[model samples]
Target: MTPSAIILIVLGLAAIGYVLGRQRALKTAQREGVKLHSLSGYHGQSVALFIAVPALFLLAAWLFLQPVLIESSVSGRIPQSAIPEGGARSLVMFDVRRIAEGLNQIVAGGDVSENDLADMRADVTDVRARLAEVGVALGSDVSPIVLQTAKEYRATDLTASFVRNIAVLVVALGFGAWALARIRPGLRARNISETFIKALLMGSSLVAILTTVGIVGSLLFESISFFNMYPAKEFFLSTTWNPQFRGGSELGILPLLWGTLYVSFVALALAVPLGLMIAIYLAEYAGSRLRSYAKPAIEVLAGIPTIVYGLFALITVGPFLRDWIAQPLGLGSSSSSVMTAGLVMGIMLIPFISSLSDDIINSVPQAMRDGSYGLGATKSETIKQVILPAALPGIVGAFLLAASRAIGETMIVVMGAGASAQLDLNPFEAMTTITVKIVSQLTGDTEFASPETLVAFALGLTLFVFTLGLNILALYIVRKYREQYE
Candidate 1:
């Protein structure tokens, strides 16, 4: 049977099994004079999953193994003169499959050009005739034992998939029907389902924990390597930013730390006020018509790709700042300065702050707002004093999230921030960031053993630690503040 037919049969059988299972379960419950174990849909779903999951798993396993097993068997049949070594065997197998599929299409189809039709007709006829000739020739030229083994290998594979499909249908339907018939009042179906679901949930949770461990392990190893070359004190305390390419590289952490802080501060400086005002206007002041139209419009900012923001910083904001603000203020020579990337990144984060703050503000109970009004507070006064404080911790969380985003932002910094690792305080002057250095040191013909490449890992570790600390702090603040409100 074809693959598509197998799939349809499996699905159709599973669906029928589900319906029958649910009906049988309900009838058994009535006959036994006991309450149904679960909702009708859950009964149906339990049976459907029981039928479908094992069958699908079997099908998937067969599909994955079929290709590898077939390739190995086919590779053995091809003469040694055709190819040597397994290095090119995989590629040749792919081409052979395509050639066989193309021939099948030629034999099956009729609407072809006169020239192409003639060629395809000849090709299919020749292949079929050659295949038959090869079968007969193999029996004679090859040793009987070898010929028998080869034919058995090919024939077994041909029926293997068909057998698997049949097995899938029989096992799934038989087990699902038997299980459904056992679903009486005291069977603990819900408990069993919940246990399965809990396992799934636990499996998902492990992924997050494993990811964190991997990051920490990578950083811990690289930082240990870095400390072997540079002392821990200098890396943490030195103010200078220069890391020498040759022997003079001073691996200090202070300069990059300063740049990270400065850029994060600048982003917050731009994002906070605008985002807060937008939130306030949307939540407290805007009419229903305007609110309906405006919220998604603001959310559109979030969907603009970060690469677009990088280009905006490089091509638009960088040049404008250079031509407008930097020239007028006599700040620096380059337009792509600390401020350019920060400002662009700030724009990118506005949606994040506004949407989160808006949710928190809106979540402030209506009773609180009514109480403030009853006390004679104006609309703005209620929001400023009562609602704002109530939502402060959540807003602070949003701020920390935005700050983390700014600190970790890559494309904008790589394109817009200057590469000079400077300690200068001027926001208009050219400056480089930790992320930019990470990208630079790790890319472009890097040697894994060299300090230059290893330093990127160290920098990455620092960034991870910094972000983790911020998230922990945010959670603490939110928890403490939530207690007061509760």
Candidate 2:
């Protein structure tokens, strides 16, 4: 039976349990001539919760664990010789899973008999072609060991799925019957149902917390592995960034860090002033009619995909700067440069800063502005002396948020800034950031056992730390001054 079928059956049982439980509660109350602890509806809810929650939880756990346990058992049966040279066992298992799925599909389509499929051998039959006929594309011809393992995997998975469906239904029926038997005037059904709902809410909250812990743990563990293979001091301090798959690579963070900071600095320089001006005009000076139209139009930039901005930087801005400005002035000739990426990234960040700053400026109390004006201050003076100071903390937060966005951007850097990792001071010369190298290092048929590939995790950890620091600083600034303003 399918999981969906099991779920439907469980739900049907829950519905029946609800009706019976409610009736039992009502009859007991009437017959005993006593006040019920909870409403009939609460008794019904308690029955449904008992029937559904534990069964569903068991079903979810089984679905998650079955493949993991089956894969572990099946993978253990495959000989080490079956794995290709310098290739992972995981890759072989991937192929095994694919072939198993394909065989299942072929059987389901009625193109192959179960007995015939079981008797087939990789050496005797064209396994790849047979799978392809059913729309499963294998990369290469299957070997005998892989074929046998796939069959085993398929059989094991099918048996597990059948058992899972049976177990889930049995659990649902068992819990439901017990709940119905316990239904009475003094059952306190409302308390039991409410407790289950509260536990569910807590579980929901823990999902996000657990997810964050998992990400950090994975990065930390992989980074430690990388640091063991490569010197941590050199990774952090060396100025060059180069990685060769064949070994003797210089994996450095300084060049990437410099490029990231340089581009972000250039971007913030352009975005901050312009966005602040826009925010000031919109919040303090612009007419309501103009503000309504102008604000959304400006914010439209935020909705545009970063890839679009990257393409814009690549096709238009990069060439324009290279031809008209860089070549004429002899600053640099390359189209893909720090300046190109920085400018385009700045344009992308404008809406973020402007929108946030506008809200922050608008949030400043009117009394502050009135006090400045009453003290013989002009409108501009009131804005500079009163409103700006009041909104400073939030405006700082907006700037940091824009900085974080700029630091993490990948596509814009890839398209606008050429992948040359160096410490050159020239803005027009191409350079790459940590994110770009992280992508490049992890791409293609790379082995995770090597320091070169594992370095991606180290780079990722560094980026995470840097961004986390920025967030912390933003929070600190906000908290330090927020109370004074409030």
Candidate 3:
């Protein structure tokens, strides 16, 4: 049975147990002529928790383990000679899995029986033609060893899936019966249900923590592999960014880092003042109807996909800057320039900063404004001296967040800021950021094990660290200033 089917079945059983448990609790209370300690719903919840939770846990654990076990078991059966030239065992395994799935499809379509599939040999039978008929195209005809390995892969996987379904049902029935038997007037059903709920909440919380750890671990592992192939110092400190698939590439980060910072600086320079002014006007000066209409309209920019923004930069913004400003100044004639990307990105960031700052500014006590007025200060003076200081930390945090967003942007940079990794001071000159190069370096016609491809991971790790640092600094500032205000 499929995992979804098993889940639905278990839930069905849990629903039945809920009805049974609730009815049983009410019967026991009425038969004993005593009041129940908890509500009937709590009794039903305790039974349902037992029926579903353990069964779901087992299903999840089995799903995670089954693939690893199957892969290990099947990998050992294929000989080293079966692996293609310049390819790892992993690549062969991918083919083996595809073949296995194709065989399953063939059986399901009644093109082959279970016995016929088991008895078939690639050398004696037209396995490739049969698989192809089912839309599983292979690059080459099936070899005997791969066919046998694929057969083994299918057998083990099917067995594991079958066992998983049976085990989940048994667990659901067993745990559910055990819980229902213990349901009585003094069973503390409410506490048991709450404890189970708390445990689920804790698991949900761990998912985020575990997810962060997994991301860091994967980046670190791939980065370590990259550093082993390329020097760490060269990657971090060198002044160029060039990757040649044929080896001896100048994989420097200085130029990319400079462009990232330059573009981000330009973006922030445009966004921060404009966004803050918009936020201040909206929060303090705009009427309620205007604020409601205007805030959502400004925030609508956030809903537009980055690719759409990229198209805008490419078609509209890039040409405008190149013709009007860059060409006139004799800076550069390229449509793709840092100034074009920065301006578009700043427009993208405006909503992020303005929304957050608006909330923070509005959160300031109105009594502070009244106190300034009582002290005979003008409106502008009150805002300049009292309100802005109180809201500064949060505003700074919003800027940092917007800066991270700008730094990580890929499409706008690619469309507006041309893919030239250079350290020029002119904003009209074509330049690129780390993210744009990371995409370009890792994409297409490259070996995964090669330094060029692995360098993407290193770039990603660096970006993650930089963004993480920004987040930490923002959190620290917010915490420190918030405590003072509170």
Candidate 4:
């Protein structure tokens, strides 16, 4: 508690001191007789920033590095005879921590000791007592080199903290003084700030760009390996999709692609109208009270973990759909089928599509609806004619996004969609999706250097390309339509 409070106080003082100092610096820079190149506020900001940044960075570094330095020094002090070579460093560090803790425990409770426990206990007490002293002896004689290393490390750390604090003060005073002297009528404070902000934005964007490049590079290398094993034509054109490499297996994609498309289409068919209607009702018809109660209820679906949804689809929804809906309509088998996975996926997508569509529908100008109303148009007529047309492009954008989400969905399909890649139109029959196959290929005992494992990369590349294209299209339509309306 004492250490924590001290740290908190130091941090609080630094921040408050920076802000107050900055304000004073600004006032000093803005004085009548001062010759300045930058604004008074900029000079103040420079002072405050310097006062805060360097000292805070030093404090953070010390807090982290101190523990590691102490541990390493203690490990070096432990004799080679006490602990062996390979495990020596780790054992010394562990025992160092335990030895101190055990002595603290001994102070509280006189516990039984192992061999040489009294000596170990004394050593711990000595180390703790000497820890604060600049170059004090550890009563039990350690090697001269170890003692010198510990002393040097402590001195270096103290020196670093002192220098860092000085640097902070110097930077704060120097920047404040410089900015005060530089301030003038022609200074461009806003442009300088904007340039700094732009550099930060570019740095952030580079992180994302690098991550995307890495993913693409990984997929490209694996896909190239896969293409070399089996001809690209056979992979794309062959009707069969059995990926088992037991005896020089046949690797085809048509069956998997068919299953993927069938499940996606089924999900879209279930999701689109239901999601659209809910969006319309929420946006145009629902009272504010009802919307407040209902909107979050619908969104709650999104928050439910995907694993739970997968279980629900497997244990509850799948059986229910199979027995009640599919079996009744003579469409699907007992539990696992394309319809089960698709229906569950559709339920998952409803909140996503409805939420986006509702926002777009609401964004259609109220004046457009008013004009239609002024022409003696009914609520339904106004919505059907004026509102829907205006919001259509955005709605399309939302649907495309939902489609991409459904395509990429893994858990529900893995649990409910059967692991059989078959080229059949029967909705009741079991089917496998690209994601399920990817999981199957990679999981359990599997060789990395095989065409079977590599196929997952090819599928991943396809999925990435497809989603990328969809996103680009959606963004273009949304942007163009937004411009039109604006």
Q: Who wins the lDDT comparison?
A: 2
Task: Tell me the alpha-carbon RMSD of every candidate.
Answer: 9.1, 2.0, 1.7, 9.1
Native-structure RMSD, model 1: 9.1
**3 or 4, greater by lDDT:** 3
> 400 in model 2: Cα distance from truth in Å?
1.3
Any residue pairs clashing in model 2, and if so which? none
- Separately for all candidates shown, the number of backbone clashes (residues 3 or more apart, or on different chains) is 1, 0, 0, 8
Task: Write the candidate numbers in order of decreasing TM-score.
Answer: 3, 2, 4, 1
**lDDT (10s digit) by residue, model 2, range 277-375:** 999999999999999999999999999999999999999999999999999999998999999999999999999999999998988888888888899
Could you give candidate 1's per-residue lDDT for residues 1-486 as a string of tens digits?
Answer: 776787787788778877876787778778888887676556766677677766776787788788688767776775554444543645444445544444334434654433543343321344444334333221112222232333344445557767877887787777687767777766666666677567657867987998889879988998789777677787788877665556566767777777778877888899998998899999999998998889989999999988999999999999999999998899987977889988998898899899989888988889999999999999999999999999999899888888888899888877777787778788988788889888877784645556767778788888998888888887887677667656
Tens-digit lDDT string for candidate 4 (1-486): 223553554455555554654455455546655655565455445444444444455556656676687666656665666554555457445544543443334433535343333344333445444333423323334333333344444444445555655554465445544544554434554455456557657867987998899999999999999888878898788888876657476767888888888888898999889989999999999999999888899999888877787898899878887888878988866688888888888888899889999999998988899899999999999989899999999999998998898888889898888899889888888898888888888883556768888888998988889888999999998888898766
Q: Pick the winner on lDDT between candidates 2 and 4.
A: 2
The true-versus-predicted C-alpha distance at residue 15 of model 1, in Å, is 7.8
What C-alpha lDDT do the candidate models reach, one value each? 0.75, 0.92, 0.91, 0.72
Q: Is candidate 1 or candidate 2 better by lDDT?
A: 2
Model 1 local distance difference test score: 0.75
Error of 1 at 417 (Å): 1.6
In candidate 4, stretches whose alpha carbon ends up further than 4 angstroms from where it belongs are: 1-33, 39-194, 245-247, 325-334
Q: What TM-score, computed on C-alpha atoms, does each candidate reach?
A: 0.66, 0.94, 0.96, 0.67
- Pick by TM-score: 3 or 4, better one: 3
